[model samples]
Target: MASNSYCESCSEEGKPIAAIRFCSDCEERLCKEKNRNDNINESEKLESAVYEEVKNWKNHIIKQINTVVEKLEIDLSNCKKKNLDQVRKDNAKISELYDSVKEKEQELKFLKEHGSNNQLYLKLRKQRKGIKDVVKRVSEMTMSYKRTLLKFEKKAEIDLNSMGSIFEVKEACDIQYKPVKLQQAQVQLVRVESLLTLKKVKTNQLNLSDRLCLSDIAVTADNTLCLCNYDYGVCEIYVYRTYLDDLTYSSTLHLPSEPYGISILTGTDKAVVTLPHKSYVQFINTEHLKLDKTIRVGEGWYGITTTGDYIVVSNTKEIRILKKMGEILGTLQ
Candidate 1:
């Protein structure tokens, strides 16, 4: 026979009723009426707390969106003002050029009409030369201004008229709670395969008239290889073009200091070469194969590599991080 349990709270109130459920935490049996009231209070408190959290979350997201919109609006206004100023300046230049051209035309007309005088022949020659010079100057100026206008047209133009697209708000879906389903199933194992096939390719032996001791090598995306040759007399970097089965020498760039480690900057026709026992790194424009800029990064920099907009240099005891412009950001010892 099953035993019937009486409610502890009801028993204390001098009215013992049958308990429907048992609470492990409370170590007591609860009747239906008392359990219903406790559940209702807990649910209300939970709903209130969740509502407050969601409200705060929505406010934070709205504030961030508003900040972004304000920043974009300010940028747009500044860009519009600058564009208008540039247009005004360009118009003024055009007007000045037009006036000068008109003046030159008048002078030429007057000189042609008064060319019959022998005493005025020398003055006519001088005025004709002046007119020729002015015409040439005006033509050059017009071409330059046209190029400037073309560049402006090619640049990005922001439209601030359709601000409703940026500021429009929408209602979000309500939060939901759902029970997750779990299932027992057998696991399957599959064999892995290799994607790469290694084979012997082409190799070239460099035969230059000048004796060279190769220090470091860097290759571009297009298979163009740059080799740093540390010679006793002159330090030079040789660029080579690699084909399917052969390599050919393209050009050479001479460096003042001894070139040590070299790395090609991705997506650009530039390479950063490190000079050992020196305080500067050379930025070579590989398009022309000449030194473009030199950035002083301190002494004892050997290995060099590019990471985004910054360069990493390694030495014996420390590693230095620097901007492309040569400013040292930090050092790890």
Candidate 2:
């Protein structure tokens, strides 16, 4: 709403006019038809509207920027918290590492200071040598004492015979003299018999043959022996009957490599022979002197043993267990 200007011509206030322009030269406000600055006034109003709209837009943009800044601040706070937590974890790990290093350093210092107790080490070594020397000296002294005892017995017997039976005083003395002679005879006979028996025992020991040496040993349910010649590369497996002390030779299944291990399968004539390389287990038909089936396995098989229902084989890396029919059961790495 706009108020009417003062009418200079009529000098009255009753006449109202629409918004128009002011005339400075005429000293009056005029309507659109009479005013020359009407266009200018309209232009000014349009410029004011544009300025107001621009101010509102600037305020909206500033509000949006503030919102974005606030969100960024919250995100920065969360990141700072995460960084602090990570730093705490890293610090804890560093502290543990430092403690470990400190312990190692302390060990090194102890080793540098007193790793070898010189006096104690010297004392122990001296004591050990002294003990060995004392043992040797004691052994020599014991042998010398035994020799002295033997010589004493021989000398005492000769002296007793020289000093006896000449002095007959009374009947009672004579009776005691016979008993004394009897006792001396018993002691001399016992000494001579003991010495003779000891000599014969030592002679027998020297005559016994010492040629028997263990060729091969096997431990199983039935203790089976396989004396394979390692130097000759011969495949002859000699099963020695321990109960009867007899050997049964089988040149049937020629083992490709030297027998690494031997295992007797229960309730079967089959025996598993492991070789140097991946030589499959050669089954020797014990009943007939013939080569039986050979159970296959992986390469580089070294050791072969048997558990309940499973034949376990060991290679460089793993133990491959298989069934009796050559199916791979499992592996233990």
| Regions of model 2 farther than 4 Å from truth | 1-216, 219-224, 244-253
Q: Write the residue-wise lDDT of candidate 2 on 1-333 in tens digits.
A: 123343333335545554233333443545544343555786699778777876787688679869967987787777678767766766675576556556655655665577777654564565566557655755664464321111112234323222122232343210111233333232222112234433322211112123322223453345444543333355444554333443443233355665556666777766677765555876655545356777878457767777667798887899888988889988999
lDDT of each: 0.74, 0.55
Find the candidate with the highest lDDT and give its number.
1
Measured by TM-score, the strongest candidate is: 1
- Candidate 1 clash figure, as a count: 0
Q: Number of backbone collisions per candidate, in order?
A: 0, 0
What TM-score would candidate 1 get against the native? Answer: 0.42
lDDT of 1: 0.74
The residue-level lDDT of candidate 2 at 101 comes to 53
- 32-111 per-residue lDDT for model 1 (tens digits): 87788786997799778777876787788779879977987787777778777887888887798778778866765776
Error of 1 at 69 (Å): 76
